[model samples]
Target: MPTPALAIVPLSRDDLPVDTVELARFMIGKYLVHDTPDGRTSGRVVETEAYPPGDAASHAFKGRRPHNGSMYLARGHAYVRLTYGLSYMLNMSAEAVDVGAGILFRAIEPLEGLPLMEARRPGVGLRDLARGPGRLTMALGIGQSFDGRDLCAGQGLWIGAIETAPMPVGVTTRIGLSRETDRPLRFFMPDSAFVSGPRKLLESF
Candidate 1:
């Protein structure tokens, strides 16, 4: 049997110039490939959240700091960090360096390397494998060690080509916890079982 072809593409900072909303939408269904020195794995993005500067909910809204300094370094950089000292969430710095904007990778559907993902998160159902920001990060082997790494040229990480199945768009308030509760900045593939949390309407907030 012929091997399945993977639509691989190396995304650079220049290709990510769109604003947070566009970036969030554009990333849907795209594969996030991580080529670690140890092995390789990938997942299709299903949900995302955008945050721009001056948005009270954004971590980098005020200014670059030692913790969020990566978001201000340059576009196409990984801004990964551990939340609640347990889960690791991944974000890509958007626009220019020090601009204080980013796209949070909220959920992913396991595409390639299911064994790897299952091994990373055993006993979890396939649908819930990478269905949350932190869980997906862990499934892809992302952690604070990947912080500040350039996704465009990182040895073990890069986003793959866009997928063909374009799922419908869904909007809602950001998930978990953030200072900007008033802004409905979260975007995801509506009706997709891969979405991380409970689906709520804007009025539910």
Candidate 2:
């Protein structure tokens, strides 16, 4: 049976927080939706990591370049990029234009379009479908082409929200980073099984 579509309110630029760290925290419990010819896939954001302006771990730390120019766009825009030459990472541009900062979508709880996500990630369990940054993009079919796209546009790939109440949020340091690893910029839902990373991080955060 086809999955029933979920009702989501499209988020606007005004709905986004201007501060990078705040935006990262705000993303928790929000919904991410991708409309495609095949179908619509949606999930509830359960994890996020902030790369604020001037953070050495941030791509925009050195200043804006051609490839990372999208990160400098005004808040509520897509700044998709590829990492490890294998997976695509999806991010939301934060802060005003010319100020490079972003929030990386780390994980989400699958809410709609399970078949599509399963097809993209065969053999992956439902809890792990969008369990990490790379898996989240792959499961949602988001790619580099989405870079510079306005997420507030309410079409194609975009972030949305339902009327559900917020969940308990947890804080922890970012994972798999060499620099600035001590900063507690990562946020996630303490109760969500869909959230990725080590069991200790999930349990302790």
Candidate 3:
């Protein structure tokens, strides 16, 4: 029998709009596929945070550099980086050309190819496998190795289409950071057993 093909779609830069909030919400439940040179792995997005160009907390808020220049390249590119010299964090570039904005993947719920994920992060509990942003990156084999990769083309680790269920009620907050210190822009699936951390209840967006 012939090898089965995955229902993958090449997400073009144009497919992503400039609306950061909508992009964050839309990304919820979608499958984030990482096709590393070593192998292929994936997971379901359960949490995300949107950051605008001028936001004080955004990495590209001030300007672009060799480190974050990818965020200004264009949409649909992966803007990954190491956090605290420990774990990797995955991000999808957003906003129009010349505008540096992106969505931070805070957490994911392991879906398909989990055995591969567990093998990657041995000794981690199944429930805590992909809970944190850094943990998820490690679980999916996303590291400096996948930096600057094009997720839209499915050429590298890319986002795949999946049947998304209704979004759980969530709240917005000034994502976990010491900067900006005042923007309530974080979003997550409330009451989800897969949440990486505790849920915070806030009013207004």
- Specify the highest-lDDT model's number: 2
Model 2 C-alpha lDDT per residue in residues 1-205, reported as the tens digit of each score: 3454777999999998889998998888999999888889999999999999999999999998888999999999899889989999998899998899999999999989999999999999999899999999999999899999998999899889888765667888899999999998999888799988853453332
TM-score for each candidate, following the candidate numbering: 0.88, 0.94, 0.86
Pairs of residues clashing in candidate 3: none
Model 3, 24-137: lDDT tens per residue? 766776778776555667676778888877887788987988888767756777889888888889888877666788888888878666678889889887788889889888
TM-score rank order: 2, 1, 3
Model 2 regions more than 4 Å off: 1-4, 199-205
Clashing pairs in 2: none
Candidate 1: worst-modelled 10 consecutive residues by lDDT: 1-10
Model 1 ranges off by over 4 Å: 1-5, 163-167, 201-205
lDDT by residue (tens digit), candidate 1, 1-205:
1232466677776777557767877787677888755567887788889887677777887788899988886777889988889899999887676588898999987877777889999999899889988889878988888888888883578875653655667778887664877677788777678998767755311
Which candidate do you rate higher for TM-score, 2 or 3? 2
Q: In model 3, which range of ten residues has the least summed lDDT?
A: 1-10
Q: Enumerate clash totals for all models, in the order shown.
A: 3, 0, 0
Candidates in descending lDDT order? 2, 1, 3
Q: Tally clashes: model 1.
A: 3
